[model samples]
Target: MAGNSDPLTPRAKLAVTAGKAVAAASRAAGRGSGSVIGGRVALKLDPDLLARLAQNLDCVLVSATNGKTTTTRLIAEALRAAGPVVSNALGANMPAGITSALAGGSDAKFGVIEVDEKYLAGVARDTDPKCIALLNLSRDQLDRAAETRMLAENWREGLAGSKAVVVANADDPLVVWAASSSPNVIWVAAGQMWKDDAWSCPSCGGVMQRPGDDWFCGECGFRRPTPSWALSGDHVLDPHGSAWPIHLQLPGRANKANAASSAAVAAVFGVPPQVALERMYQVQAVAGRYDVVQFEGRDLRLLLAKNPAGWLETFSLIDPPPTPVILSVNARSADGTDTSWLWDVDYTRLTGHPICVVGDRKLDLAVRLEVANQHFQVCENLDQAVQLCPPGRIEVIANYTAFQDLRRRVGN
Candidate 1:
């Protein structure tokens, strides 16, 4: 039964039961997690199953090119302080997976959903969330997803009349334009590390003029909004200007930025910044990201970086000099078929590390590293790469599918 609504109709209830059965069967067969397939079956039976499941919960949607999964986890944890919260803890952000998540947690009071960028508008329409968090947007899965500006336009069109309170990043011009149509917005100055995709204004198509932490269009004046919440060096400033130190087990400034965004979104659900931060601090790892597992007697820290923007943040989280770093790349369907995005990453920053490369697309990554004048050794597999590393902590950074491959092998 839904937490705040009437009982599900007979059709929807049957759909939910069948979906759960399929999901369980999938897990038993080890085919996959079955979140997507199960939800697909359910939706096929009852097209409105997602909306039906979401009807009784105060849903919150988190969507972005990067950090959506981690941010979703953070917000879910923070919301738990208020009551039971349901979330797709795995990296399933599509409609089917989201439906599965909601159907599975029907009794929960809150739904924290991680939505794929392209699917955000549809999911938002179906869920009618109380709050939506638009994190940074950058070039990711270019072969499969739309360009940043097109996505921004889609968001602008889809969410034009949404009654949800949008918690958006003020630093990114693209996000600013996308959320510009919303009547209720809480802008957070979460820093944007990759600015290449947002140089052109989404409104006027003019070159954006960025001056020392602020951005504005030169031709049509589409500017960055004044954020009520801001992320400083190592702290997050609330709307009242009180700075809260972001102490997290998660690595890098990106996670700090994610924390700031999560805090702001949590506040919409009546969770105070102090309480939210306290709950979020308990999340050490999000879906194998930043998880350190033992592989052949050495500690292997797994970091997932699918695109250039993600790689930038992952590089910052690497252990300093001489720690053996394993760079993995894949061009599977999950990872974009094109590996050209490798050139956009700064591999030169990894100069001081003992770098070992592996994955389906290692040669492509090798060429990028060579162009940057960085030395690396090519290994056939993760095990072979780990064998080459000296004893102690070994950092493994991989793209989408490659990371999952290693995670399964290492039993994370």
Candidate 2:
């Protein structure tokens, strides 16, 4: 009864039913965390459920250190114009989440999935995607994993013989190295805001020559490939040498780059550039990302910054000086138990603004801010922290668990 499970085998059907029941029960008990728990249950019953569900559909897997959820939402919106599209709309990227979404939307013919950076190779193999969008990669969740380069090498191995067309960010040396051996590749000159991680070449382990946006290895000559698609601010240059204006409700040049990447992928399936751009403009928020919510009579704009790279890109979106910013950080399990990345963020840029540091690790954030001489005050309570800011247009930036907590409390 999970929207159409007739195509599944009897055993798979039983697993799907049980999973749906669990999800319903969790929601009834007010313990729903999207599809994670339910998907876990389903996969435990039938480990091959995702592969079975993805067999008949044309899937597009999206993976990145940042913007995976937003990018997936953009691509899914673009694909929906053609016909029914199924996606893990909750911003969940693991096997369980993918299974739950595909099972629930069985009747849909297209799947747009956001995959975790570490799980990309395995999930790509299972989904056998028609197109894989490889966004920028940088150091993230260092508490859970040691190396981003190792993951890149794994992805390189994973796509060596894949039949799917890969849309990759050429400015990112790590991304370029990851999809280097992919048989069918379409590169995009999506700007790389964070260059700290890509200072060294992935191929020769030598110093990379980055003289602007163009990068090449000094030792082995692993240079950035010429992009098929390029983004210059809000304008996108397509493979056909045509420029299209991409206007979006979402802020930042990064979002424009995301739209450009989506447009490139959509064009592979005969989706018109105008059509894709039009749909992308309709996405105001993905799950709880970029939502302005009213909580305790205060309107706060929620922004999720999960890692250093994410923080860098998101900080650029904030309206100029004199804006009050609420910075939150949590060292919870889901957020990876390391808070050392806080020191790596360029908090000094926010020296002129009034910042309210609030989260589970508020003290740690305050210490870092104080060390950087940023104008900040420690307010553990989120609501009270917002009150410290100016009256209108407040921006609250939080890490993984803190962001989720704020989104849930705001009732968005």
Instruction: Write candidate 1's Cα lDDT for 121-236 as tens digits.
Output: 99999999999999988998878889889999999998898999999999998898999899999999999988999888899889999889988998997899999999898888
Query: Per-residue lDDT for 167 in model 1?
Result: 99
lDDT of 2 by residue, 1-412 (tens): 1144355788888889988888888888888654888889999999999988888788899998988889999999898877788999888789988898988876787899999988898999988899999998888888786487888998999989999999999999999999988999999999999999988888879999988778999899899999989998778899898888998999888899999999998987778888899989999987777888876566788999988899988888887778888999999999999889888899877867788888899999888888998888888588788777766777899998899888777777
- Pairs of residues clashing in candidate 1: none
Residue-level error in angstroms, candidate 2, position 9: 1.0
The candidate that wins on TM-score is 1
Model 1 TM: 0.98
TM-score per prediction, in order, is: 0.98, 0.97
Cα distance off (Å), candidate 2, residue 161: 0.5
